[model samples]
Target: MTKDLFGRHRAVLPDWLALYYEDPLEITHGEGRHVWDAAGNKYLDFFGGILTTMTAHALPEVTKAVSEQAGRIIHSSTLYLNRPMVELAERVAHVSGIPDARVFFTTSGTEANDTALLLATAHRRSNTILAMRNSYHGRSFSAVGITGNRGWSPTSLTPLQTLYVHGGVRTRGPYAHLDDRAFIDACVADLEDLLGHTRAPAALIAEPVQGVGGFTSPPDGLYAAFREVLHERGILWIADEVQTGWGRTGEHFWGWQAHGRSGPPDIVTFAKGIGNGMSIGGVIARAEIMNCLDANSISTFGGTQVTMAAGLANLSYLLEHDLQGNARRVGGLLIERLRGVAAQVPHVREVRGRGLMIGVELTRPGTDEAAPEAASTVLEEARAGGLLIGKGGGHSTSVLRIAPPMSLTVAEAEEGAAILDRALRSI
Candidate 1:
């Protein structure tokens, strides 16, 4: 049955779309952190559908909200005033931290980032953008144009003049050998130098924790340093929090808080996890920036009643349960466990990240060369051991990405760690 479904998927789905295991796993249902395959085999879910399941699977609040909203209305286009949309927007704006914040909804992160780009370029009167070295914003043309990672970017031809900036990844670059403070200084210096040689850029957009780039991030204060330089030149700062927002990072409610020494970002784009598996992405900015467009804009499917209701319920549950604090405590323990395991595994190069989002980079035994094949092996082994994980990175995709639901328990963390230990040993 699984083989037949896999064949059907490959026959129709895009060839570029990658699957996880040698034999693809089909999930039929899930509850809490566990999911069942079509064969009725249960597995602990650590990746959470690429971290979109913010709270947990089969979360009652979100399901009830979605069901009630769906019974009444699922979508009515942006032409009408949606009560749930307005309520969700109000809640998002309050938590956004931007002064006089306004919200614009979209169906996905790509559209959210696209709207941000439109606003930034129109407000600054330039199409040039500054992005981090190994960033992955979204898959749209505009979002992909600013992405600096080649593995995710397929084409270089784009309308936006983007300058790839240093300082996103702190482990493998020229400044990797430096201490945290010196590394921040070097990246800032490079940014200042880049500005001198280019046209006036509209904004510097970046992922606080690069999701597709192996969940990597720079020092906590690196973006604060960059903010100082960009603010001086009237350039905007757009935080792509699709993977790191709503307290998933544990340290802060938003990943930008780690770099908020100056202030909140000028524009913030968020997606995954907000709706707890429902499709909801949004951009938040101050009125001046959000209203820069001379003409009106609307997303027909964005902020439809059903999606907004799900987002509202998910956000409420997450905040009410203090999941951010849970993430901080649980994630700290999980990282320590993984670090101890990695110390004994030569192929495990590094373990980094905060909150629930963690990365274990695999490399050749004695060298810095990425071991993509090893990553694949570990993933397959983890699955065989009744656990589901994820893989990603900039260099041939060798990083083990582990982002469990924010509601993860200490026992589940221990169980997942044990499984990972066996998987790495199998490597």
Candidate 2:
């Protein structure tokens, strides 16, 4: 019955309510690439609030925009047009390179994903959806149903019309090396086999870079091939960019663009970093697909005036500062450093992912929870050394996930890497 530092009522909460019980460090404030606890202890933030603070926390531009909008107008029903909403939608479409894209706003990534799911089912007149195994869409009923992780499965998921595709198959042992071509072929084959028995799905949804799935990148030509197959089957290809969008992947404003494909997806969803820590999520859909959706099926708080203002400010920052370029440069250094660290540590099994979204897989050295323990130890030790990191993947809390803000500097990257190195050595 330990009480929180604030003297709030605290008890042994259930796992569902453990998020509140966990004594998260009280971050009093943040700036640039660092956050401070209530005690004024500065910590280098590598996790970047799970990659939501793209432009950095307390960004002056974003803060001003939000403040101004709040002072003037905060909420405007989706029925009425807001200037910021319209401008933000235009910017998202322009950056996505998707012509005639219709935007539908939501309060969070889960809501946006839920809307996308509904649109898919309604447009194609099919209930089935194809999603990548190990993928994490969200926590809502529909979003969770489509999520590939079994740990997120609810008691009644059997009734949902969802199918899973093994994006990356393990051919070696636990630390298997993946052959890109073979993996893509297997995925296509799996989909084909499923289609033979079940009805053609409404859409095939996937994260461009599998975020929670160990930050794994798909095989080359895989996205193009997947789109072709879906088109042939008269199904939509919905790229769930909730985690990979907004310059986090570098090389492109959106991760789908990094696929090096000319044809855009039928629908692309975005959330993290869209408002630079403010609550906002949106879906950009091709005109044809959008036209099919009922206009009345929008969210009440979808395009709040404040959220729109934050989105616009965030987008402006990204475009003006060329944060995407910085992401590429800094991300290259990060990958190199991670690879070097892996080479030095035998327990470090693999280093995977693209750009700033990185994952370090640990092997079972001697402990029963070797991989997970190593990851936890690294995170704890990093925190003690003035850095905050996150965890994800197989064990529901194992893989060391590092997805920093796009605005992070090279020096910060070096410092975070050094902290990681020290943590590994200590562990």
Among these predictions, the greatest TM-score belongs to 1
Clashing pairs in 1: none
lDDT per residue for candidate 2 within 1-427, as digits (tens), equals 2235434523444445333113557777888889998878899988877789888889999999999999998996878878888888888888877778888889899888888888888899888999877778887888888887666655446335888776532422232354766667776776788878888899989888877766766665677777777778898888889888877877676777755463888889989788888889988898887778666555689888899999999888888998889988999899899889878876776787777888887777633243776777787888889988888775455578898888888999999999999887776
Q: lDDT score of model 1?
A: 0.95
TM-score of model 1 vs. true structure: 0.99
lDDT of 1 by residue, 400-419 (tens): 99999999999999999999
The worst-scoring run of ten residues by lDDT in candidate 2 lies at 168-177
Q: Candidate 1, which segments miss by more than 4 Å at Cα? A: none
